[model samples]
Target: MRVLSCIVGQHNLWLVLLAAVVCVAGSWVALRLLLRATDRHGVQRSGWLFLAAVAAGSSVWCTHFIAMLAYDATAPVTFEPILTMQSLLIAIAGMGAGFWLALYNRLPPEIGGAIAGLSVAAMHYTGMAAYHVDGVIAWNMNYVVASVVLSVVIISAAVGATIRGTSRNSLLIGLGAFVGGIVSLHFTGMTAVSVTPFVTGAPIADATVFATMAVAVAGVALMVVGTGVASHLIDSEVTHENIAALRHLAMTDSLTDLPNRTGFNEYLHFELQRAEQGGRSLALIGIDLDKFKEINDLRGHEAGDEALKTIGRRLLNLSRGGEFVARIGGDEFAALKRFRNDDDLREFIQRLEEALFKPLTIEDLEITCGASLGIAIYPQDGRDAERLIGNADLAMYRAKADLTRTVCYYEPQMDEKSRERRGLAMDLRSAIEHKELELKYQVQKSVESGEVRGYEVLLRWKHPERGYIPPSEFIPIAEESGSILAIGEWVMREAAREALAWPLPHKIAVNVSPVQLMHVDLARSIHEILLETGLPPRRLEIEITESTIIADKVRSLDALRRIRALGVTVAIDDFGTGYSSLDTLRSFPFDKIKLDSSFMKEIETSQQARAIIRAVLALGKSLDIKVLAEGVETGMQLEILRSEGCHEVQGFLLGAPETFVADVVAVEERRIA
Candidate 1:
C-alpha cells in the first residue's frame, strides 16, 4: 500500500514522461545498430556491436538516472560520483558481453536476447545502488524481485523479435517492448525503495543538482542515439548506390557500353511475351559485321575496340521508339523492333544498315565496314525467344553467304539448309577419321615444250550415299566446321607419300585452305611429312591463294617464310582476283604465280582479260617468279600463254585430273616415250 502511494503521489509526471521518451528513442537506435552489426563480419561487425552496446547502456543508464530524479524520496538525495560512474561502466560491459554472446550461431539468438535482458536488470540494480540520501534506504524484496523478472522478460522478447527478422513490424515491436522494459524496471525498482529521513552533519546535494544531472544525461543520450541513426541512414544510401552500380556493370558491355548478351536475352524474352499479349508483331534482327576479323588482324585490338564503340554509339543513337539494340558477340549485334507492316520493317532495316555501315574513324584511319542483317518476325518465324533468335541467325548466315544480298528475312528453307550443313560437317569429320578422302592429280606442263612438269594435287570426296561430292560443296563445310585442319594435314601427308612413287622427281603442288594456312604450323608439318615419306623437300610445293595471305599478313608471311627456309616452295594461287595481288607478291618470296581461271575463260574473247594476263605475266617475269596459266583448255589459250613466255600451264589441253596414281605415271611414261 505504501509503495503504490509513493508511485501515485511522489513522482514528477513530466520528468517521468521525458524519461520514457528518451528510453524509446535510445532503444530504437540501439536495435538498429545491433541489426547492422549482425549483418557485418570480422572487425567491422565488432565495431558496430560496440556502438550498439554504448547506445543500449547509455539508454538504460540515462533512463534510470532521470527516473530517479522524477521520484520524490521526501529527503535530500545526491548520487555518489564514484559509484555512479562504476554503474555506467557496468552497464556498458554487461551489454557488450550480451551482444558478443548473441553473435554465436551455436546458440539460439533468443538465448543472446535473454542474456542481454539480464544485463538490463543488472544495470538498473547497480544504478539504484549508486543513489545516496540523507536518510536510510530500504527495498521491498518482493517488489525488487518483480521488477527484475518483468524487465528481463520484456527485454528478452524485444531482443528476440528484433534479431529474428528485418521487417518494419518486427523493429517496431522490438522498440516498443524495449521501451516498456526500461520504463517498467525503473518505476518498479523505484516503488521498492522507501527512505527514512535522519539528521546529517555534512552538506548534501539538493533538487537543483539532481535536475541538472537529469537534463545532462537526457542530452547526451539523445546525441548518441541521433549520431547512430544518422550513420545508419548514410550507410544505407551508399549501399543502395553500390548495388545499383554493380547491376549496371553486370548488364552492360565494357567495351561498347551497350547491353550485353545476358541483358539482351532477358529483354528479348520479356518483349516476346509482351508482343504475344498485345497481339502485335515484333522483328528480331541479327547483325554480323563482315571483315571484322580482318580488321582485328591487320590493326590492333585497340582499333577493333574503337570500331565497336563507334558502331555501338551509332546503333544507340538510332534506337528510338519501340526499338532496342544490344551487342551480343565480339562483332555481332542484335535489335528488337515493333513494326506495323513490311514497309516499316524495311525502313528500319535500311536505317540500321546506314548507321552501321557509316565509316568508322579509328586512329585517324577511316574504315568502312559491311554488315549482313537477318530479320525474324514474331509469330511468323518464331513464337518464343530461342526460336526467334535461332531463325534470325540462320537468315543472317544466308545473307552473309550470298554476295549480292545484305539483308534477308527468315525463311523456312534456311533452317533446312543449316541442318543439312551441320549434318554434312559431322559426316566430314567421320570421313577424315575413316580415311574416306582421296587425292587426284592435275598435270602442270611447260607452255612451250608441251611437256609435263609436275602434278598439282586436288582433294576428292566420294560420299557413300551422295555419290561424288564436289570440292565446291564440302570444302566450305569443312572450313566453317573447323575440320579443315585435320583434312589439310592428311592431304599434305598423302601428297608427299604419293609423289614419291612418281617415276620422275617432279614438283608436286598441294593447295592449302585459308583456314589451315592461318591456323596450322605449316613449316613444321611439311618437314615432318617429308621425313615420314622420305620425299625430297624441294619436290613439295605449297599453293595458297591471296585470300589466305590477306587474312593475317604477318602470321601468314611468317609461316610461308619458314616453309621456304625448309626448302619447300610456296606459290600464290588464284592471283589477280584478290584485293591486293601485287602487294601480296611484294610481301612474300613466292616461287610461282597461278593466274585465276576466270581470266582464262575470257582471255580469247575479251581484250581486258588479255591485257590483265599480259600484265601479270610481265610482272611475274620481272619479279623472276614463274607464271602458271590455269585452265588452258584450247590451243589459242596455250599459244597466247606461250607467246607471253608463261613458265607453266595446267588444263584439259595437257591432261585432265586423274584419280589413279598409275594413270599419272603412265602419262609421264608416254610423254617420255
Candidate 2:
C-alpha cells in the first residue's frame, strides 16, 4: 500500500487522471459507434466496426503507457518499440473479435463480455512485457494471477452492461469498464512486481511518448464521430422513403392503384371552387355498375376484384383532359369533368357509354357489365360537395331503376322523392317497433276445386297524415335504407302468429325480399318465429322473387334449402317478370311458381301471353310443380287462366285482400256455391 501511494505521489496525478478520462471517453464513444454500425441495414455499416477497433484499441494502449510514466522506478523507464507495437496490434485484433461476436454473430452479451475482458488482459500483459527497466524484476504469481482475473471479471461485467443497457446508460457502463479495468489491472500488476537495483539503462523521454499517444487518441476519436455521422445520414434517407410510402397508401386504393374516396372528395371540392370562380360549369358523374352483385354471386370475389380493376383501367382511359376519375365505393365510381358547351358534355357521356359497354375478359370468362351514370351539374344541382354528391347518387339510382335509361340528369323532383323515401324509411323503423304495420290476407283459390287453398300475406302501411302509403312506395324505400331486415322479421313473426287464430286450415305465404334472402341465419330466425307462434312449418310458405335467387344464387339457394329442411315450402313469386331461367327451377328445388301479374293482364287479349302461360304451365306440369297465376282481376282473365290449366289464381275477381281473416270457412263456402 505504501509503495502504491509513493508511486502515485511521484507522478503528476492530474495527468494520470486525465489519461483515465480519455480512456473512458474513447471507450464509450467506440461502443456507441459499434452499436450504430450493427443497427445499420447494409454493407456501409462495416466501416464503423473498423472505427470501433481503432478507438478502443488506441484508448487501452494510451492509458497503459500514461500510467507506466507514473511508475517512479530508480532507473529511467522506457517501452520496447517492437513489443509495444505488437501489443497495439493485439488490442485491435481482440476488439475486432469481440465486436464480431456481439454484432455479427449476435451472441449473448455475457459471451461477448468474456471475450472483451480477455482482450484487455492480453493487451495489458503484453504491454507490461514491453517494459524496459535497469533492474531485475520478479513477479508474484498470486498477484499477477489476481490482476488478470480481476481484469477479466470487471471488464466482462462492463461489456455486459454496455451491451444490455439502453443507449444513455451504456456510456456510463462503458466508461467504468474501460477506465476501471485499466487502472485496476495496472496497479494490481505493479503490486506483483519486486525490483532489485542493478546497472543503469537509458529510457525513452516522457514528453515524446505523451505527445504521440495524445495525437493517436485524437485521430481515433475523429474516426468514431465521422462514422456515426455517416450512419445517421443513411438512417434518415430510409425514414424519408417510409414516410412517403405511408402518404401514398393513405390517399390511394390498394386494389385499383387509383385515388380513393377521400382523395376523390378533396379533388372534387377544389375543382368545384375553381369552376365557380371561372364561370364554367362542372359535372359530377356518379357511376354504379349494374348487376355487380350478380357477378360477385356467379363468380367468386377474386374474379369480382379483377373485374373492378379492369373497370378502373377502362375509366382511366376514357378520362379526357382536365377530368379526374376515382373509385369511391364498391361497384361505384365518380368522375369530375369540365365542359365549355352542352354538346361536348353530351359527346363525353356518349364516349363513356361506349367505353364501359365493351366486354371485360377475366380468367376465361367474358363478362358484359353495364353502368348507370347520373350527372349533377355545378351551381344547378348543388353548391356544396355533400349536396352535389347526394344529388348525383339519387340520379344514379333513378337511372338504374328504369331499364331503358342508361343516364339521368339530376332533377329537383328526384331530391323531393329521395327526401320522401328517406322520411318513410325513418318512419318505418318506428312503425315496426310500435307494430303499426298490418298483414292483409289475399285468398288463393284452386281453379279445379273452386276452394280456397291458402292466403298470401301482404304488408300494408298507412301514414297518420298521408292516410295510406302503398307497399310499392314504402317497401322499396325500406329495402334501400336497410330497414327491411327488422321490418321483414316482424312481418314473418306476425303473419305466423296470426295464422294460429284463423279458422281456415290455409297456409300463409309470406313474401321474402332479395335482401332478406341474403341472411345466412334465415333458417334459425324462422325456427325461432315458428317456436314463438306455435305454427307448424307446413302451414308457413316463404315466397321469394326470381330476382332474390338471381342476386346471390349460391347463398340464396343455401338459405332456401335450409328453410325447406325445416319442413316449410319455398315458392318463386313474380316469376316471369324477372330473368327466370328454366335452369334455375331445375337447379333450385322450388315447390311452387307464381306467374307474374303482368302476364295475366295481357292473357285476355294477347294469344302470345296465353301461349306463354301455356308453356309455363306445361313446364310446371312436367316438373310436378304447382303454377299459380297472379292478378286475375277480370272474369275473362280468370276464364283464360282456367282454360290454360293454371293450378291456383289470386286477384280481386276471386277475393280482395282483407285486414281480418273473417270466418274464412264461410268465405270458402260462398266461393264454392
Candidate 3:
C-alpha cells in the first residue's frame, strides 16, 4: 500500500511513462538479439549476446535514472560519477555472464533468467548507492527486501519468456514483465527512503540538471536500442531470402531451370493426394526422348543441352491449368494432369506430342526431336507415387520398343514383362559367372573357290528350364540391362581362347555391341585377351554394325583405329541396313564389309536388293575392302555374289554353326585335305 501511494503521489506521470517506454523498447531489442544469438554459433553468437547485454543494461540504467528524476524527494540530489559508471558496468557484465551461461553452456533458460534477474536487482541497488543528497537518509529494510524480491521474480520471468521462443505471446509476456519489473523495483525501493533536510546547507544540483541527465540517458538508450533493432531486421530479411534461394536450387534443374526429379516426386505425391480427395483421375505421363544419346554422341553435349532447354521451354509453355511438367532425368521428362474423360485426356496428349515432336534449331543446326510418352492413370494404375512412376516407366520402354507407336498407356501385361526381364537380368548375371553361356562358330568362305577363310563367333544362351533363349530375345534385354558389357568381354575372351586351339590359323571374327565398343576400352581389352590367349592379333577380327559406328562416330572411329593399329581387323557387319553405310566406309579403314542378311533374304525376289548388293560390292572393291555376303544359302545367291565379284560368303550351305571345338577343327582339316 505504501509503495503504491508513493509511486502514484510522488512520481511525475509523464516521466514515469517515458521510463516505461524506454524499458519496453530496450527489452524488445534485447529479446531479438538473444533470439538471433541462439541461431548463431561461436564468435557470432557471442557478438549478438554482447549486444543484447548492452541493450538490456542501458535500458535498466536509463529507466532507473528516469524514474528517480520523476520522484519528488524534496531535496536536491546528484549521481556520483564513478559509482554510476560502476553500476552500468556491473549490469552489462552480469547480463553478459547470464547469457553466456544459458546459450554457450546450453543451460536451462530459467537458470539464466534467474541470474539476469539478480543482476537487475544488483544494478538497481548499486545505482541507489550512487545517489548523493545534502540530507540525512534513512532506509526501510523491509521495503528494500520487498523491492529486491519483487524485481528479481518479475525480471526472471521476463528473461525466461523472452529466451523461451520467438513467438508473439512469449515476446509480449517478456516485454510486460520487463516493464513491470523496472517500474516496481524503482518505486518500491523509493518507498524505502526518507530524507531529512539539513538546516543551513544549500542544494548542490537543481531539477534542470537531473532533467538534462534523464534526457541524455533516454537519448542514448533509444539510439542503442534502435541500432540493435535495425541490424536484426536486416539480418532476418537476408536469412529469409537465402532460405528461399536454397529451396529453389534444391528443387530445380540447373541446366533447364525446370523442376528436377526431386521436385517431380513431391509434385506427384501432392497431386495423388489431391486427386484422391477430389475423386478425380490424374495422369502421370512419362516422356523419354528417343535417340537422345545419339544426339549427345554426334552433335556434342552442348547441342544436346541446348535441345533440352528448348524442349523444356516448350513443355512449360504447353502446361496450363491442372498441368505440371518436370524434367525428371537426362533425356527424360514427366507431366502431371487432371482430366474428366478420355476425350480430354487424348486432346491434351495430342498437344503434348505435337509440342515435343516439333523440330528444334540448336547451334544453327535444325534437328527433329521425338519423345516416347507413357501414361499411368490414378487409382487404377497405381495408388502411390513410386508404383505409378514405375508403371509409367514400363509403358515408356514399351513404346520405345515398338517404333510404330510413340504413346502408350500403362497395362498389366507391361508389368509382367518388366518382372520377367528383371528376373532374366539377374539370371543372366549368374549365367556369366557360372560359365553357362556357349559360343558357336559359323564358317565364312571365299565365294570363288569355296575355300575356308574365317569363322564368325555367335553367342547362344540355353536356360535351365526354358531350354533355348534366342539372341533376338535376350540380346535386347542384355543391352537394356547393361549386362552387355560383361557379356561382350566374356565372348571376346572365350572366342580368342578357343581360336588359340585351332589347328589352322583361320581368322576368328567376334561381334561387338555398341554398348561395349563405346562404353569400355575395346582395343585395350582385345589386346589383353590376345596376350592372355597367346593368339596372334592378325587372327582376330572385331565385327561392328554401321549402327554402332554411327552411335558415337568420333569415339567409334577412334576405337576402330586403335584396334587396326594393333593388327586386329575391323569389319562393318550388317552394312546395308544402316542409313550411313557409305559414310561409315569413308569414316574408318575397315578390313571387310559384311552384307546385311536382310539383303540376302530379298536377293532372289527383289531386283533392288541385287542392285544394292552389286553397288556395295563395287564400292567395297573400289575402296580395296573385302565384302562378305552373309546368309547365302542357295547356289543362285552364291552364283550371283560370285558374278558380282564378292570376296567372301557365309551361309548354312557351306556349313551349319558348329557348337563343338572338335567339329570346327575336323571341318578345317577336311577343307585342307
Candidate 4:
C-alpha cells in the first residue's frame, strides 16, 4: 500500500494512461495475426507461429516496461541488464509454447489460460528483480499469491472468449479480457514490492537506453503484424483470379473464343429480364451458314475452324452497344439486340448482312459463304428466351428454303408446321422397328408396247393414329434428321427380297437420298444385302438426283462406279432441275435419265416443252442412254412423250403405286390373259 501511494503521487499520469491504451491496441493486432497464422497451411505453421510470438511477446514486453518507465520512486533506480533481458526471453518463450499448443488445437482453453497466467507471473517478477534501488527489497507473500491467482482467473476469461470468438464482438471481448489480465498482473505485482532508500555508490544507468529499447520493441511488433496482413491480402487476390479464369473457361468456346450455348442462354435471359422491366424492345436473331458442311468436306476441319474464328471475330466487331453475339452450334450463330423503333431494327438487319457477307480468308484461301438470318421480336413473337429462340429458328428455316428472301420474321403458321415437322422426325426414328413403314411399287411401262419393264419403289408410312402419312411430308424430314441412312438400308434389303419372289423379269428401282451417297461403305453394304437376299444385282437399280453428284463430284462418281461394277444400274432422277445437267451426263455415265415432270405438265400447253422433250430424247439417242418420262398423268402427256420417242413412262394415269404386290400381279395377269 505504501509503494502504490508513493508511485501514484510522483508518477507521470499521462504516460501511464498512454501505456494502457497502447497495450490494448497492440494486443488486439497481435491476436488477429495469431489467429490468421494458425488458420493457414500446416507445413508453414511453425514459421507463422514464430512471427506470432514476435508480435505478441514484444507487445507485452513493451507495455510492461513503458509503464515501469513512468514510475518515479523518489530514489534513483536503475535496471540490471541481465535480469531485464531475461524477462523478455521468458515472455517470448512462454508465448511460443502457448501459441504452439493453440495452433495445433492440442490444449484445452483452461489449460492455455493457466499457461498464460504462469507466464505473466514469471515475466513480471523477473522484471521487478531488475529494478535495483541500492537497498534491500521486501515482498508481501499474500499479495504476491493474490496477484498470481487473479491473473489465472482473468486470463481464463480471455481464453474462453477467444476459443468461442468468431465475430467482431467476441474478438473485442477477448482482447479486453487479455489486456485487463496483463495490466492487473503488473500493478498487483508492483503493490507486493517495498523498497528501503539508501545512499548509492554506483551511478544509475542512463534512462535514454531504456527508452530506446522500448521503441525498438514496438517497432518489431508493428513489422510482424504488417507482414501477416499483407500476405493474407495477396493470397486472397490470387484465389479470386483463379476462380475468374475457371469461370471464363466454362463460358467460352475453346475453338473460336466466342460465348458458347450455355453462356449465350444466360446472357439472353439476363437481357430479357432487364428489357421486360424497362418496357423496351428486344430481338433474337438466328443465323446459319449455307453449305458449311460442304466447305468442311472439301477443305478440311482445320480450315473450317479458321473460317469459324473469322466469323466470330467479325460478328463480335459488328455487335453494337447493349447487344450480344454467340456461336450456339457448329456453323450456327446468334445475335441479340435492343431497339426502340422499326427503323432501328431495319438498319440492324442491313448491317448484319453487310458484315456476314464479307469473304473469309483462311490459310491464304478466300472462301465465300452466305448466312441466313431469322428474327423474332419481343412481346410479339415470344415472352421468354426459349420460345423466342425457337421461333427465330423456324423463321430461319423458311428463309433458307425461300431463295428470294434470305431473312424472314416469325409468323404464327410457321410454329405449327415446325412443331409437326419436329414431331414427325421424333416418330420416324422408331417407325421401322414398329413395322409402320412399307414400300409400294409403280409400274414403268414401255411407251411403244406398254409392257411393264420395271417398278419404281415408293415409301409409304401408315401411322397408327394419323393414318396414311404422305411421302412428301415425311421423306424430307427423314433425310434432314439423318435417319434416312438406316431407313435406306432397310429399304434396299426389303426391295431385293420382294423382287426375288416376283415371276416377271422386271427390275426394282429404289430412290437413294443424297445423304446416303456420302457414305464410302454404301456399295459394300449393298453387296452384302444382295447376297443375303439372294436377289440378282441385275434386277436392282439405284436412282439418285443430279444434285447428289453435283455436291462432291469426284466422291460421288467413285461411289457410283463401285455400285455399277456390282451390275446394279445407276440413273439420274429429276434431271433438268440440277445445274449443268449436260456436263454431269458427259462426265458421269448414267443408265437412264428420268425427265423432270415439269416438262410432262407443260407439254400440253406449250410447244417449248415439247421441243425440250424432243431435244432430251435426241440427246439420249446420241448417247445410247434411254429416256423416261415421269408424272405422266394424262393420255395426252403420254402420247406427246411417245411421239418424242420416250422409251418408258410412269405416272398416275397408268397406275398410282400399289400398296400390295399381289394386287399388282393379279391386274397384270388379267391384262395378259
Candidate 5:
C-alpha cells in the first residue's frame, strides 16, 4: 500500500524498499551462481564462503524481520534509514567475511582467492558508505584515487595469496595485505561522502570522516591476516607429523619396536661397505635364540612375540648406538660392529654374551634362553654380505654344538664341518624313517661296591652311508632343523623299550632336546610312550642340557616340575657347559647330573676340569643326588671319576652307544649273569 502510495503521492519510500530487497536477493543469487561455476569447472569451491554469506545475511534479515513485527513498522525505506543502516550492515558483513577467511590460517599456504576477495570487499564497503552518505567530505577528488588505490591493494593481495604462503611466509604477505587495505580504505574515505555539516558549507565533523574510516580499515585488516597465519601454521605441523609416522614404520619393527629385517640388512650392507672401503676390521655376529619354538608352542605365540621383543630390546640397549643390531628373522638377530682391534671385537662379543645371559622377564615370568653367536669378520672371514652371513651362520651352529655362550669366528674347515653336519642332519631324519636310529645301554656302576647299577639308554644314529655318526655331530643338526622333535619322540620310545627289557634293578636315561621339552603335551607324550613301551615311568630318566632349563627359567622349571611329577627322572645334561652356575642350579630338582664331555675329554690333561668334575660330584653328594660322567674314554677319567665317588660312567672304555638291542640284553645278561 505504501509502494502504491509512493508513486502516486510522489514519495521516495517505495523505490528504496524495492531496491533494498533486490540488492539483498541479488547478492544471494550471485554467490550461489559463483559456487556453481566453481563446481562445474572443478575449481576449488569455497563452502565456507557460502556459509559465511548465509550467516551474515540471515542474521541481518532476522533482525530486520523481527523489528518489522512491531506495530506499524515495516522494513525501513527511503535514504534516511537506508543510509543510516548501511555502514553498520557492511561492518557486520565484513566481520563475517573475515571470520571465514581466517579459518584457513592454519594451512601451510594461504589461498589467494580469500585474500583477494577480502581486500576488494573492504574497498567495496567504503564505496557503498560513500554512496549512502552523500556530500560527506569523501565526495571530493579522493573518490577516483581511492578506487584506484583499493583496486591495486586487492590485486597485490591476490598475487601474494596466489603464490601461496607457508606458515612462516604468510605473515609477511599478510602484513603487505594489511598495509595495502589501510591505504585503499583511507583514500576511498577521502573521496567518499563529505563531512560537511547541516549548514551547507560547514566542514564535516571534528575529525575528518575519512581519517576515522582509515583507522577502522587498519584495525579490520589486522584481524583478517592474523587468523590466516594461525591456520597455515597448523597444516604445516600436520604434514610434518605424517612424515614422521612413515619414517617410524620404515625403520622399526611393528611388534618388537627394535630395528626390523630391512633396517638390519641396510645396516649390515652399510657396515660391510664401510669396513671394506676403510680397511677397518668389521665383525658380523649372527645370534639364533635356542629352542624359541618350544617357548612359543608352550606359552602361546603372543608370549613368544613378547619374549622376542624383550630380547631384542635388551640386545639393542646393551649395544652402543655405534654398533648396528636388528632382528633379521624370527628368533634370530644380526649385529655388525667395527672395532679397534681383535681384542676390541672380542671384548664386544664378551659384553654381548653377558647381555644375553641376563634373565628376561616376560608376562611377569622370568624366562631363560641361551643364544649362539657366530662371528664373521671382514677381509679374513668374508669379503661380502652373502659369504659373511653364511659363514657366520655356520659358525653359530658350531658354537651351538658346544652349548656355551659360544662365539666362533668363521674358518675354512668350518665350511666342511657345517656341510657335513647339515648332510648328517638330513640323513638322520631319513634314518628314523629307515629304522637306522637305535638306542644302546651303557652300564652305570656304583663307585663304592664296584657293582653294576642302572643303565643309561642313549640314542645312537648310524647313517648307512656315514657309519656311526656321533651324537655330538648329528644331535645339534636335528635340533636346529626341528627334526629333533621326531628324533626326540623316537628316542623316548626306544629308550623306554630298552629299559623295560633290562632284568636287573636299573633305570634308563634318555636325553631330551629343549624342543621336546617345550611340547605342550610333553607330559602326555611321556605317559603314552611309557604305556606303549611297557617301561615303568619311574625307571626312565630324561637328560636335558643346562641351556634348556637356563632359557626361560620359570617356564622351564614349571615344565620340569610337571615332568618330575610323572615319575620321569630330570637330569641336567652337559651340566657346567651353559652360562648357569651352581647358584642357579639350586632352582632345579635334578635326580642326576651328567658331566659334559668337554670336562670328560680333558679330565686327565686339565686339573681345572678334574676339579670341576670333582666339585660337581661333591655337590651331588651334598645334595643327595646322583652324578654321572659321559664320554669317559680313558681309564684315567674312569679312575678319577671312581676316586671322586662319581655314581656312574658311560664312554668307550665302559661301552659306546650301540644300535643293537642285543647289546643292552648282553649288558643286563652280564649283570644277571
Candidate 6:
C-alpha cells in the first residue's frame, strides 16, 4: 500500500476516507438510537450524544486519509524509492492538518458539519496536489469540481432535515450523514483510480477508475436526499415540545408553581364539562392564606415561599379524583370537586384548614400557616366556571375578613364590595393621571421653634359621587392592584414640584410602598423628577417603612443607596409599628425617623409607651437622626413631645389634611399670626 510518503513508509490517505465512510454508517445508527432514547427527560442528554457522533465522524475522516496514500504504492520501476519518499511525507502532514481543521470546524454543529466535510475534501485534494504539479504552482481542477458538487449535496441535506422533521435528533443525524458522505466519496474515487490504472485506453471505461468516480458522485446525491428527509422530522418534535410548554404557562403561576386565574378558569371549564356529562354537581372551594404579610414581616420572604410551596403540596395531596386545586392569585387558591351538596365539601375544607394550620418544618425550624376557605356548589351557586370561581373567591375574602377558617357560601352582598374594589382600581389610574389626587400638607412644625418648617404630602382622592376617600382605604387597594407604582411615582413628582412652589420653602416627604421600592428603576424615576421639577435633593424627603426596606433588603438597599447618593433626605415612616431593629436604622443613613402614631396614642394611658418613646429618642439622638412624632392630635401629647426634644410634629391638632385651595398655607399663616 503506497500512494505518497507523508506519515511513514508510503502512507495511503484513501484509507483515512475509508474509515470515515464506516463512521458515517455508525453515526447514522446513533442518530436513530438518540431519537428513540430521548424521552422528555432524555432531551437534557442531547449534548453528550452529539459529541459522540462528532468524535466517531472525525475518526472515520482521520483513518480514510491515512489509508489513501498507503494504497498509491505502484510507481515506475526506477524511481520508486524517490516517489515513495515524497508521497509518504506529504500524506503524514496531510493527516495532521485534516485533524486540526476538524476541531476548528466542529463549532455550532449544524452548519459546522457541512463546512467541515467540504473543507476536508478540499484540503485532501490540495495536499495531494502539492506533490508535482507546476513551476508556478498548479491547482487541482478536479478536486474543485468535486468540492462544488459535494457542497451542493450537503446544503440540500441540511435544508431538508430542518423543514421535514419535528425531532432535533433526526436533523443532527441527517446533517452528520450528508456532509460525511461527500467527504468519503473522495476515498471511493481514490479506490477506483488504483484498481483500473490502464485497462481501457479511452481513460473512462476502466472498471476500477470509472466505477469509483461514479459511485462517489452517486453517494453524495443519495445521502443528501436521505439526510434531508430526516431533518424535517426533528422540526416536528421541537414544535410539539413548544406547544406543551405554552399550555403549561397558560395554566401555571410561575412564582408559586400553582394554577393561576386563567388556569383555574380552564380547569373549572373542564371539570364542568365532565360533571355535566356525568350529571353530577361540582363543588368549587376557594382558599386564601390568612395574614401572609405577618409571615413575610416576621420570617421574611424565604419563609413565605416555603409556606406557599408547603401549602400547595398539601392541597395537591388532599385533592381526590375529579378534584383540581390551583393557586389562583396572590394568597389565593381554588379547588373543585365533583361532589353533590356543600356539606361534604365543607367537611373537606375543614380538614384542609386543619392540615394547613399544622406546623411545617423548613430549614430545621417549625413554622405555622393557616388558610381561610369558601365553598360554593356548582349548578346551585350559579352555573359557569366564572360565576362559581367568583362566588368562591368572594366567600374566601369574607372568611378572611373575620379571621376564621370557616367555610361560607357566597352572598349577593359580596359582589358590591368586589365591584367597589374594581371601580377604585380604575379610578385610581384616572386620579393619578388627571391630577384628581392632590397633596394636602399637614404642617410639621419644630415644637421649640413653633415655626411651620415641613409638610407631609398626604394624598387626598376627592370623588364626585363618593366624596373624599381617605388614603387608608385606597392605598392598600392601589398596592394590591400594582397601580401603586404609577401612583407612587406621581406622588413623589407632584410633592417635589409643589414643595418647590411653596413660598415658605420647607422640606417635603413622600411615601413609597414596598412594590414601588422594589422596582429596579425607582431611583432613576426619582432623579428624573427632581431634574424636571428643579427641586434640590436636600429639600425633598422619601419616606419608606421599616417593613418596606427589609422586604428584600439587598434590592431595597440598592434603591435606597441610589436615592441617598442624590443628596435627598430619607426618613423611615411608622418606624416603631413594625419590628424595626435598632441596628437597621444605625446601618442606613437616615436623616429623620417618624415615630409610629400607635406608640404616641398609648403614651397618655401607658407609662411603658412613654419609656419606649424615650428609648427611641435617645437612640435617634445617639445616631444624630432627627426624631419626628406623628399623630399629635392633643395639646397634652404635643407638650410631652415638645419636652422630649422631638424635632417636628404632625396631626389634627396642628391642621388636618385640608385642600390647599390655591394657597392654604398662606391663609393658615395669617390665622396663626
1 versus 5: better TM-score goes to:
1
Instruction: List where candidate 4 sits over 4 angstroms from the true fold.
Output: 1-212, 376-405, 408-415, 425-436, 442-454, 462-468, 476-490, 511-533, 541-673
After superposition, candidate 3 runs with Cα above 4 Å error? 13-18, 75-97, 106-115, 126-135, 149-161, 164-180, 197-226, 430-439, 448-452, 479-506, 514-538, 546-567, 576-588, 598-619, 631-645, 651-673
TM-score of each: 0.88, 0.63, 0.84, 0.70, 0.57, 0.56
- lDDT accuracy of residue 226 in candidate 3: 95
Worst 10 residues of 1 by lDDT: 200-209
Residues 205-312 of candidate 6: C-alpha lDDT, one tens digit per residue: 233552364346335433543453354356458768898899899888876677888988887888788877888988888887765766776677797787788888
The residue-by-residue lDDT of candidate 5 on 102-213, one tens digit each, is 3345642223334433434453444344342223233444565555456445534533442344465553454455334433443343334234323345333322333344
Residue-level lDDT tens digits of model 2 in 151-267: 777777776777677778676876677567767777787777776757655653465565556556545644554554565567668868988898789878888877889889999
Runs of candidate 5 with Cα error greater than 4 angstroms are: 1-130, 133-223, 234-430, 464-468, 502-505, 578-581, 600-614, 667-673
TM-score of 6: 0.56
Question: Which pairs clash (backbone N, Cα, C closer than 3 Å) in model 4?
Answer: none
On the 0 to 100 scale, the lDDT of residue 495 in model 3 is 87
lDDT of 4 by residue, 213-273 (tens): 5556556655655665676567568768988998888888887788889899999999899
lDDT of 3 by residue, 25-68 (tens): 99889877987898899888989999999988888888888888
Q: How close is candidate 4 to the true structure, as a TM-score?
A: 0.70
Q: Scored by CA lDDT, what does every candidate get?
A: 0.86, 0.80, 0.86, 0.81, 0.63, 0.66
Residue 132's lDDT in candidate 4: 71
Candidate 6 or 5, higher TM-score: 5
- In TM-score terms, candidate 1 sits at 0.88
Ranking by TM-score: 1, 3, 4, 2, 5, 6
Backbone clashes, each candidate: 0, 0, 0, 0, 28, 56
